[model samples]
Target chain A: MAVNTIHREPPEQSAYRGVRRVDHSPQIFNNQPARYYLMWLLLPAVLLLAAISLYPFVWLIYMSLHEVQLAPGKSDLWAGVDNFTRLFSDKSFARGWVTLFKYSALCLSVEISLGVLVAVILNNSRLEKLFITIFLMPMMMAPVVAGFLYMFLYNGTFGWYFWLLRSLGVLDGGTILGNKSWAMAGIVATDVWQWTPLIALITLAGLKRVPQEQLEANMVDGAGPLRNFFSVALPNLYPFLLIAILLRFMDNFRFIDTILIMTGGGPANATKILPTYLFDVSFKFFELGRGAAIAFTLLLLTILLGLILTKIFEDPTRKIKTDGMD
Target chain B: MTSVTIKDVWKYYGKTMAVKELNIEVRDNEFLCLLGPSGCGKSSTLRMLAGLEFISSGEVFFGDLKVNDIPPRDRDIAMVFENYALYPHKTVFENMANPLKLQRMNKTDIKERVVWAAQMLEIEELLQRKPVELSGGQKQRTAIGRAIVREPKVFLFDEPIAHLDAKLRSHMRGELKHLQRRLETTTVYVTHDQLEGMTMADRIAVMHEGVLQQLGTPGEIYNHPVNEFVAGFVGEPPMNFLDCRIEGAGDSASLVYDNMNLALGGEQSRILETKGAAREVRLGIRPDDLTIEMGTDHGLELSAKIFVTEPLGGDMLIEADFGQDRMTIKRKIAELGQPGDACGIAVNSEKLHVFDRDTGEAFF
Candidate 1:
């Protein structure tokens, strides 16, 4: 046998023969260190963030410590903790937190359920892209505009919905926004209409990422559609669902605009949620110190809620492995 | 176990026909492989049998039942996808026990069955691990175990081991064949690899362009391909083909290519005359059937220059150029050859294949 050895040079040695290595030493600018350049590069964004976010936050804290009279002849006075003390004693302020909780819970639950149902239905449809675009129209509309549109539609005299409710004997010709019992329900309905599509869009993306093979395997394993959803599809959608719910929760927690435009905290403050109360205290009655106090409290609550949700989202097993490093 | 029969089944995706007029019967406890290249409809036919895909027309029967309208779950079939398809969030035990749980079986029985399948696949120790934590081969075993725990009427494997490394794939091939035999279930496997099909299947069905080209045992399919496609597709390094013309009739017929004239054997010549074989045909020969020597000594020998030599462990594959045509010959490693060297080659007339040039159908 004539065996010929095909001698080939090592690839790295041949390819690198004429090439020069890149310098890894730190670079300098104008006789300054690399950190100086980094600081300069970040200066614009840092300054802008400070001007917009930090400056306002510090001013709010400073304002919360002093009572400033809106009257031209009056002077500002140091209030110490008096404004915060008033926050606890104010009945409307206490009721606002309760209203905020109820609204967030109701809106988030209904939105997530309806969004998942829509996403699942659209996932199997042949005209998925067309229907998805159509379904997303509500979310594309500005929330304040949607609120105004719903307000006109909920009017007792000429609104189509009011007439339908009266014909159906559900409302007996009463205005949806004017009735105390239906005021919160009307605001919640408007929020659901405008924001449910956001949840649906995210859920649809998650549904698309579910492996087709796994679903087929489920079918072959004797799972019906319902069983497949519970065992396979639902588990795969958890991470995305969690994210969607968290976003909706946070947004609903600070909700104000739609309620402000539609109900204006009417019908004996039935729809007076936290942000609406904040607006009423700060701009309407001009209680700048107490409004700043309420604002600071809401910020703290948001941060705490975010931390708790993030803790829940972390996988316990992954957490344990990371904790072992300590 | 139940035998599966597909009768005149056709599948269409939009306007494109994926599987056309397919009819096949997988006997009870039989291991049948659907073998073809990509887009050849082998996977489509298997999916139809599994009831994962609807048959565009015709019927599929399991034993005495016509299952054309039956869903996959009702058909009592289990499948292992190419990606394994083990539930990512579930432990191996949960994955294996899922089918039994869906059947509403008791907890103890489900556990026993899952453990038994795990042991069968030699993955008992990894039963508690999630799919993401296991290696590819282990994941494949879990998928097989999931199917096994179902103990369904038929097992459908859609290139299940295609993703594994070569060594693991070969090992799993043997394991799957043994497991299927022990379980005595009717199994239909699909793969584009001819080697996997030849090694594992009791019968091989070769498809091309949505049409079944040939159906036979591995030996029969390799020895007697019905068309040029199967002949070219089945062998390692593939069979070499030369454009040639058949002249004369009966026993005097000969194949003429370039300046070489080779007389046909008696059996081939008789068969060709009966078929009214086309004058323009392709002469097919496996590289293993050609013999190369240092110089021409026989009347049937032809002279050619060696183009290249590839040593593939056990044998040397030589590409020899005869005029403008090139044909590969598998020779013993002891047969020394260099590029530009002239060698005499003789084809084994008994093993030669002849096909119509235009239609690609074999004459015999």
Candidate 2:
């Protein structure tokens, strides 16, 4: 596919003949657009990709429009916009969306703030290499495994975190995953502990790329070390932070492993986020059509969020102008 | 604004010494250029002066106060970096006004000062644009404007125009020198280009291998280099050196080489006689000093075959073979020669330089 974009003529005889610049603009033949030969060659792979991604999406829409059959050889019943219409009246679906946002917001805010702070401190520390490796250990653990680990820590019987919280008079002897007030915090803590390091790692990479000359220039311009970070380093880190946030947001819409393991949507559906609710509707009640409807809405929201983020990315104020990047 | 003195300063990054026992005093309101090739410690010396890097074991006095321990923020200095490190997020106006804002200057004053600098640099239209939107020359101008707006005590420019295109570089060189003169701030400019140093600096300090080779006016450094490195590093197409033996008995000393026997001028011959007895020495001459003509001319002591002729429009550079050494002669392109063609070379008598062959020290 990439080969189609390259000018097919010999490089020395091409437009950049004398100057030695590698001109990668698409080849145009006789003042007309060039044919994409490589695209035809990649048709098989493209078809396979379409089957994997497109087929399921089409099946989802189809399933969302009908009462899907559970047993083999059973005919499905048609439901005309009934499933989507029912979603407006269902309180659990509404609560699930609100809870999903609350959960994601809680996790993202804590992760981004704490992770960036950790990254800043660890960037040039004496033990930077050692600490980076140590901090990344949490991200290496499987989410399901981390959930089980945290479950033990949140246990009312012998959990050390529970004991610490109780002794500190912050918990009032309530188990983190059992109480309504603490269950949301419990999953958020678990997510933060498992994924905050990923944000830190991305931020650290961005921190490494913050122009050294810019920092030195700022120093000479009469800014202290702290002000230097605020003025120069933070602005450079914005794109990286935005990418990290979007990645985590997308991940939030998909990941239900830890929540399923730790809370199972909680004692009274108090911790039921949309993904957890969708899992119950799809797997527990076998309401495949309703679940498909819910899943489609979640997918739509994600796409919408992605588009908005892309709009923000393309905003001129945030984009640093670069030369010959295309 | 103030005289800056670097006294016996040395910089060691880990175990490697970048600048070794360097001493230089940039006079009040004088433009001093630290000139050298890459890894020659000129940038490191400038950085130490700007208080960006710590001096290993010496004093850097800004007037009377030793600024060795002071940070760059407190040093009251502005530096234009090689890459023109303007803030990517900020507009040119904001970038220029940053220093004034750091001083907590009033908004109206900051805006006025920035506008004034923008007009001086002829970048008033570009002030609203970010660094990325600007061309290489525009970015360089913005970087210069940022430094000039502050009116700091000293300005340290680290090859600020190095990244510009050839035409813009020459243009900026003149403008930068003019700006420095008008501002009358003590400026330490570092560049590897000899042209920049010769054309812009009041005094050029030629450095090589972490050592100060010579500190003199451009003419002095160009004509009477203290050593071979300064002579070679400070000229375009560089000074060509020929290995020869000094073989005269008394006041008449002549450099002898195969196919080349050149008599030294009376003044240089007398200086050589005062120095020591006859010995082997290397003769140095600038490309402009050596004359090359087609065919043989018997009166010219040295005759050699032409290697190549490169015509650079109005001028010509002819590389001629003097036994094992090749010498380039720069002259107008009125005469032309082909490769392997015989040519006569004439050495302008007074411009000849003889160096101690072993030590590479200048004899005259």
Candidate 3:
């Protein structure tokens, strides 16, 4: 009875069953390795990057070896290593690197410490979202705009900050920008005001990623608030804090617009960091060759500093490992 | 060790009440399990005891000292969370030594205690490894080891073994029970698994929807559940409830369903008579208490067709379909029959449970 009731194909399907089968192998284009195809797909983006960034960088290196002339009739002269030699001999150029080192160190340390404090406080605050939004307003503004705003605030004649500082005995009579001793302090203050929020936001995101249960466990383990912060929260936040510091350090190394617009390396060149000094040598002094040499030196310095920072802070052991069982 | 008492404790998250007017006393060195389903306030009660959660009102006492305002660290209680809550960055020895370190204990003594705990938990070899290097059961053992190393006044467990696989969970259950017995600490364990509660707890406090359903020893909870929920919840296969109506008020009273009737026994009728058993009542019976016969040669016979049969090793669970209701009956595997077969069901009268339909309160 089972054999009689077995399923049988229709006459049309049975007739076509004997026909030859077509080959279904992939075509030649599809047979190639996936990475080979991906390389072809990414060629356009690579070329675009070279055109915009790599080509200009190469051209700048070439121009640094020669004395470039902007006039159409004047021929460019081979200066050899004269531009590089002049960068080291120039007193303002030497002072620019020193000034930048000091500024980057001071600004980064202050911003990181303050940012972590603010993030911790705000993380525990009831109005965290509202306060975070308010704190981030300065970072959203254009750097040139912030520079102009601080320039007005530092004006001795009608600026409210100047008047308040004078009333408070902080500044006796001189403008903060015009005074050689106070000019760098004013620039650092402006940079801190505009950039501290970025570090705080990054640290806050890291703080939120901390497993809440671990904090509660610490409480049960007899850890007070301060001990909990040091033993549990801080260890978990190490990677994020390091990343924030590295990014802030790199950004501050090349800092230019605020100081350029506000001080213009003025007041006896007290605020002339590397980037501003390069601007002065290239545009103000019309010495493009020496400016390019300084730019290249700054790039090398940044790479060296970045490598050192990464080596010190980018240890993968900083991450808290979990068994992934949970 | 000290006794813990919760008096009129209410926990509220904003306006929503998570635990309502709870009162329980845990004697010194007693193992008490707060048993419930999810969102049933058992964890909240345990957390309140641990001082991890704030009490909205009322007082928690640790041997006459009110601890409503005391922080968790000062409360002298250790907790094992469901996720094991081991510090990922710390090794097992460090995790176990943390509490002692907080108390400014010397390195030698902290190491001694941690080693002792690790040995007791059979995790001495894992002491050098971090939590990330341990498996689920090993991590749980470390968590327990950490708790024991503190020698706190009380131990709170929030479903600590709920994440383990079945075999490992059962194995760890025995280990935890034996360990608690040895330590003699006042322990409050929370779990949604009834088996864990029944097997481990000296006294089981069953809760439902933020209210305590019943609190008794395992035997008492199983045999004399105060309400329908407790009866249904405390059992493995759960109690079967059949809707019926009471007919004839006096000695001739019987429970009647569609075309079927069961005479009320003397004790049950007397209790129902005094309680004024409403016209409608639910017949609650455990699957194990129901006897199945191949044919009708029994007292209070229920004609039913077998819906399905699940062979559970020694015992077979059969779903029997009556006129409009289905009930589960446990039978010996050797006596099991196929589905669609007609069978006679004889309910054990002494084990029968009757609840008022409206209030769901068990009468007998």
Best-matching candidate per lDDT: 2
Candidate 2 residue spans exceeding 4 A from truth: A1-36, A313-326
Candidate 2 chain B: worst-modelled 10 consecutive residues by lDDT = B292-301
C-alpha DockQ for predicted model 2 = 0.31
The positional error of residue B303 in candidate 1, measured at the CA in angstroms, is 2.8
Interface RMSD of each: 11.4, 12.8, 17.0
Candidate 2 residue-wise lDDT, B1-364, digit = tens: 8999999999999999899899999999999999999999999999998888888999999999899989999999999999999998888899999999999999999999999888888777777788878788888889988998988999999999898878768777777887888889999999999999999999999999899999999999998998899988988888998888887856687888875677777777888888773488888999999877678754576788989999999999999986677999999987678899988888886788888887888977
Error of 2 at B257 (Å): 2.1
lDDT score for candidate 1 against the true structure: 0.86
Model 1 chain A weakest 10-residue run by lDDT: A1-10
DockQ for model 3 equals 0.19
For DockQ, candidate 2 versus 3, the one ahead is 2
Computed on C-alphas against the true complex, the DockQ of each candidate is 0.27, 0.31, 0.19
lDDT, model 3: 0.86
Report lDDT per candidate: 0.86, 0.88, 0.86
lDDT, candidate 3, A1-326, per-residue tens = 11112221122443666777766965665555556788899999999999999998998998799899988899888999999988766888889889898888888888988999999999968999998999989999998999999999989889878888889998865899999888988988888999999989988999998888888989999999999998888878877888888888888877688998999988898888888889988998888888888889988898898888877665333444544222
Tens digits of per-residue lDDT for model 3, B1-364: 8999999989889988888888899999999999999999999898888788889998999999999999999999999999988787788888999999998999999999988887777677778777777788889988888898979999999999999888778777777888888889999999999999999999999999898888899999999888899999998899999998988776667888776688887777878999998889999999999988764453446888899999989889999898889999987876767888888887876788899899999997
